[model samples]
Target chain A: MKLKTLVLSPQSRLDEVCSEACRARINDYFEPVWNETGRDYTQEELSERMAEAEVIISSWGSPSLTDEMLQKAVKLRAIGHAAGTVKNLVPKQIFAQGVKVYSAAPRIALSVGEYCLAALLTSLRYLPEFDSAMREGKWKIAGLKGRELTGSTVGIISASSTARAFIKLLAPFQVDVLIYDPYLSEEAAARLNAKRATLEEVMSCPIISVHAPKLPATERMLTRELLALIPDGAVFINSSRGPVVDAQAFMEELQSGRFFAALDVFDKEPLAVDHPIRTLPNVLLSPHIAGASVQGHLALMEEVVEDIIRGLREEKTMYEVNEKMWEVMA
Target chain B: MKLKTLVLSPQSRLDEVCSEACRARINDYFEPVWNETGRDYTQEELSERMAEAEVIISSWGSPSLTDEMLQKAVKLRAIGHAAGTVKNLVPKQIFAQGVKVYSAAPRIALSVGEYCLAALLTSLRYLPEFDSAMREGKWKIAGLKGRELTGSTVGIISASSTARAFIKLLAPFQVDVLIYDPYLSEEAAARLNAKRATLEEVMSCPIISVHAPKLPATERMLTRELLALIPDGAVFINSSRGPVVDAQAFMEELQSGRFFAALDVFDKEPLAVDHPIRTLPNVLLSPHIAGASVQGHLALMEEVVEDIIRGLREEKTMYEVNEKMWEVMA
Candidate 1:
């Protein structure tokens, strides 16, 4: 028997992912939104389309499948996200309905971690302005006043895939690694060559990077108080979530010249024209492109497609947030 | 016979290099400038210092030993500069005095070379602003966009010592190295994993660093026309003397986003406050501290002291700019 599935978000190579689902004997693959005009199924098109879909694969900018949509799709079995976080589209309603969901957060983990390592090194060397100065043909020697990473302390503030992968990438460097994740066991931190510390200690480190999820307990992990504990000129990276640090407080501190920063994300998307962050010389700012590299997309698609194939074969989900196990595990 | 040598530069750690010189049978080290009673020296005092003084070790910023000063000492056999270039004090008059001049350019070459390499890597990574961003408690995933050094092209504009060290450092990264020194031999380039190239091709490279000496031939080696050949977003570093680059032209190009540069030296030291270079956001202007690190000072002193020792042992100078060699070797 074939298990029907619908993909909400359309990638350029939909054929590639569809073929993988086909290999696992899931014969039906449809994008309900794409099927327009003259189609006989008019009322509740999404519901009608997904009513029989055993799995739904989603990506960035995917439409949320709401309670009304879920009500009609009584046969909805699983939701698979091929991106970093499901919080963007996967609603609380999905959990309430007992719908299973999966995410390839682990696959995209290395991309963020690799970026974090580069950001870490960049911060230690004071390179951002050095490069800009070089462009202007001014031989500024202040760039030479940077600390080597050989004996510096690096604080990793999470135990998620990004944080874990960051620790793995830093193994070759001579940094004194400290990690602060309540979920991480002492044995795990030991094996990872990182000393498990409290959030207090991590923020006080010479180099601190945040990779925690946006759970209630983790939101605002780098609050104003925590930010004050951070050392001057130390590098801080946040690839986890934007709300982890308070932006207003950050701008105040940055203006005071008490520390240095490399911000790829912000509490608000597309920081307004008057944002102080855009003008600061000490900051390395972008439009949040770190985890969206070519390599990042490649890893995500590979992992998500693999899960789609395996789920069809074994009739089980991987990286599922809405899995039944969460009910008992929670 | 003891060879009395006068130290012109006040290197407190002068003993370390002198120790080696003493071991090599160099003797009678003296410096009258170290005395506060410089109003005048009695004939007895002058004879005690100059009766057997066979060598003088000098460097940049050293006071010239004029005809009047030299007349007080008749046995001065050789003039050695434990630093780069002798134009500062060794004028036509000193050469006319038939003093065999030696410079310790090679000894400090390797150290300056290391600093240049560090600058290149730091520029490539964009670390300084990132560090500031980290301190400001800003967490952004898009703070920096980095390019790996692997397979990247780096053009060396000259075969100076630091340039050679940079080529050696590039060996590990497997970068595409190019050289454009008119005086450089194909064999020398090959040994350093560099392809001998025309000035045009060298300029075409994305990473170009100037290591030419401040000689008449190399004045403004990187003119406005040469700057045009470089691709956008390429890195330019100058650890060599600043005259090789036209600051105004390069600064203009950098402002227009046509090039990027990291200059440790400038045409004018302490770059004037009103200097347009300082106002430009793209320029990394420093106080010419690239070759002025603690290591750089130590290296300079070590070489000068070594020369003093070697002068006593009748050893060949570490860096001899033979007036005769330029025709055949330069």
Candidate 2:
């Protein structure tokens, strides 16, 4: 008999996340029950669905599997989280109960990596500046000659999954990559085709990207002194969390016009209307969208579904989140 | 003994094109004659330099080697051109005289390829649009989800050096590439890891890039019908010469907002003051800078100098342009 799988995501989100082909695959693998209601499940509804589910498929806006809900889920074997983090969605106690947890963080990491790379290339070539100049009917903008990413040095702040994905994307370009990750060993760095360096050395590169996670230890990791290390004409990109960087120092550095920056995250979302960063010509700002994309969302569902099927078949799954991984995950 | 080489380009240009290390390498290879006048050589000065030089190094603004100048250049065995095209710099008669010609067009092609890839990634991610929206202090602008280059189809119009460079740079992305070059055989397309397709089939791809040369046969190659084949939300890039595309048809297609474009070349550049393309929201315009960068310019000199030295040593040169190649080259 096929395993009983309960999908907590509403039908509208299921339509967006899973293509018809994916839904067909899901039907083939399990006796699936989807939330027909057009919105998130209520606590009573979640408990009712959890009681019969051998596996749970969760995504954004899905109700958390609280202690009371878990008590009712006697048949639960595993959870496939179609989202970046499973921290808020699944309680840690589920692991002691021998429940398997699979996350789609790697899928989101790929999207963030693509965004970081695209931002670097765009900033290095001054695409936005040139587009603005051309819009004003101005050609031959002085001092606007572009720089090639080829044969240059790229610095990455952390050896996070997102950073690894970005490094893989940069393989085609003949660039030297320097990474500063306290957790990464020399052999690991070599495997990634990067040299392990201090934070200062990495920051000094002509192209520096930050991919540090937002842990208590990492908050304000990029201090004023580190931010000041970026040289003139350098391009800085931050697709990671904002609190990991010193916001005031980053703004001051950009205001000085010493370097260019592409910021996808800010200390505050919906950045204030009077914020000075909005008026800075040397920076490219976005609405905290480096990780979310239509393709990414779809891929997340596919990954989780495939992993769920693998777990049911007693096969190795690619994205299983063990208890050890739960502590350091972003 | 070092070979006798006359640099026809001005001192200022030489300084801009060649780095100090490149100059040192050139001095090591050639008993060089520099243009200390800080300007391009006049006809009289050119004739005087040609009388004793065994090799000539030419660049932009350098005087052409006319019949009169060639007659005086009895000792000239080769010409190294530090620019994209040598057609305007060296007369065809020089080839018949057994004088080898080498150009820096391959170097320029690499730069153009880098620019094209950068532009495509920038456009696909809506980097410019997001930046603008954020600059205006707006967040959550509806319908701004990004697309990934991974697992997408890319269409290339030609198999020129620039296009080949671009195809090489796309190795990391798991994208299916299609080519519409009549000159390329199916076997050659396979070697490039791309499928050979007709113009209409190529244009049907969501990511289409035009790299056709400017030739009589290729003029207006992208007709109105072909431009209309592009699907909605597709990205179009044209980094090659502009006259090869039907400008009016392209403009109309872009005006409809069916697709986005990043145009680096124009039929009439320093594009007209009142051209409607200047204000198009779906297009990114650059000032004819797809092939020119500080690193590209410096590499041009280095490549030409290396080829000149190799030729002097009776070795195979990488950038040699023979008579047959000259006929079909852009």
Best by TM-score: 2
CAPRI verdict (incorrect, acceptable, medium, high) for model 2? high
Candidate 2 residue pairs that clash: none
- Per-candidate DockQ vs. reference: 0.09, 0.82
Q: How well is candidate 2 docked (DockQ)?
A: 0.82
List where candidate 2 sits over 4 angstroms from the true fold: none
TM-score of candidate 2 restricted to chain B? 0.97
Summarize candidate 2's per-residue lDDT along A1-330 as a digit string, tens digits: 888988888888886677778888888888889788889997788887778989888888888889888888888998999888887888778888888999999888888988988898888888888889988888878867888899899999999989998999998888999999999999999999999999999999999999998889899999999998998999999888888889888888888998998999888877887788999999988888888778888888889889977887899899999988887876
Model 2, B259-317: lDDT tens digits are 99999999887799889999888998899888878898887788988997787789988
| Segments in model 1 whose C-alpha atoms lie over 4 Å from true places | A1-58, A65-83, A87-151, A159-176, A181-204, A220-258, A263-330, B1-202, B210-226, B237-256, B259-287, B291-330
Instruction: Give lDDT tens digits, candidate 1, residues B67-99.
Output: 565665577867666555665555445455656
